[model samples]
Target: MRRFKHLFFLLLVITLVPMTSCDDDDDDVEPSRMDLLTAGEWSGFAIFVNGADVTDFLASDEDEPIDVRTWKLKFNNDGTYTIRGDGVDPSPLQGEWEFTNNEQAIILEGDSPGDTQTVEINKLTSSELFLNMTLEDEDSGTSIDGEIRFRR
Candidate 1:
């Protein structure tokens, strides 16, 4: 009985020793969806609609449109976002933003929040953010393919 008890104790210790061992990665938690978003500032690089360049569409009315290169978007860690540029009303379009569908989609809800448009994330990296969205022309009721490209 004594030998049996000692063997049992040894087995138990062996099983638990590895379980409690110090791991270097104990504090290295993978970044969350929100963590990746708030990491940098994104500048509008280009816009395409129905395979057509529309980056200058907003410039049609201006004699000399402010350079669109200055447009910037900053995602806050607090579930909020801000976009400042020549076209964005109020300078900064402050509001909330989130990732859905296991972070495959992004939705931005700013002032006058209407039906949330789920934009598909084409590419999301430390230096770039590419998104695709579909918008319907109200007059034609035809679906239009659109893409928004940004860079950090």
Candidate 2:
């Protein structure tokens, strides 16, 4: 009777094993980059144009090198962002920002439509944000492709 009971128990265990399932939905889900961008404020990391230093232009009328730490960017949950200068320039540019191209690019809208830009996101993390923008320098009358990096 004991042997028969053991045999029945083994059969029950075998039958239950196939009924068990493991869920992986959580593991398959990817965290959104937009969520990370809106996580906190970020400061300028670096700015380059055509493989040259053009960050001096980031400031409006400053003779000194712009202190990157003073520049700020804040992305909000409402799909809006704010850009501020470090007082590094006499007239620092500040404006609104948004994600476009299905969240693949960021559009920084200046006071006028002609001053707006659509930048591709190279990388975005809790601590770092990298972007590439093609811009036309109204003063220089030259088209420029630039890379801008920021850090938290």
Candidate 3:
């Protein structure tokens, strides 16, 4: 009887041990890139055009320097975004955005057919975002590279 009791206790422990060790929170899913992008609003802090700092010149007047730091972009989970600020190009622009190239790039489409732009994502984190793009003039076929930095 004593030996039988010992065996039963050992079996019970073995069974219950795995049950207790098993994770109950299996549904805790990790956030995806879309989640990160749509989490908060982003503000533009810097802009580079052809390797030159053109942030101040974007919305600046002849006498006063306008800062691009006030530029704001908010991305929605439904593939929509809005840009608002005094110095920001396409200011007060509303657009639809989609991720491409396995989320390495973003294509933005505005109300007009010619407002399409593609930007390559250099880096994206919870706090910072860096994007590079090429702007081409349709008439002259001149292409200019640009970089924009943003922070949340």
Task: Sort every candidate by lDDT, greatest first.
Answer: 3, 1, 2
Off by over 4 Å in 2: 1-29, 50-69, 87-95
lDDT of 1: 0.78
Candidate 1 residues lying further than 4 Å off, grouped into runs, are 1-32, 57-68, 113-115, 134-143
- Reference-based TM-score, model 2: 0.63
Candidate that scores best on lDDT: 3
Better of 2 and 3 by TM-score: 3
lDDT of 1 by residue, 43-131 (tens): 98787877787777745536435334668989887788888998666787787888899999978887774945678988887778878
The best-first sequence of candidates by TM-score reads: 3, 1, 2
Per-model TM values vs. the true structure: 0.64, 0.63, 0.69
Error of 2 at 8 (Å): 18
* lDDT (10s digit) by residue, model 2, range 1-152: 99999999999999988777565664785558777888888888677877776666665445444545467878787756667776433345655777888888988766656867788998887788988977565557898788878998
Clashes of 2: 0
Per-residue lDDT of candidate 3, residues 1-152 (tens digit)? 99999999999999999898959699788778798788999998988887788887765756444465887989999999998886445678899999999999999999788889889998888888888987555557898788888999
> Residue 98 in candidate 3 has what lDDT?
98
Report the lDDT of model 3 for residue 127.
88
lDDT of each: 0.78, 0.74, 0.84
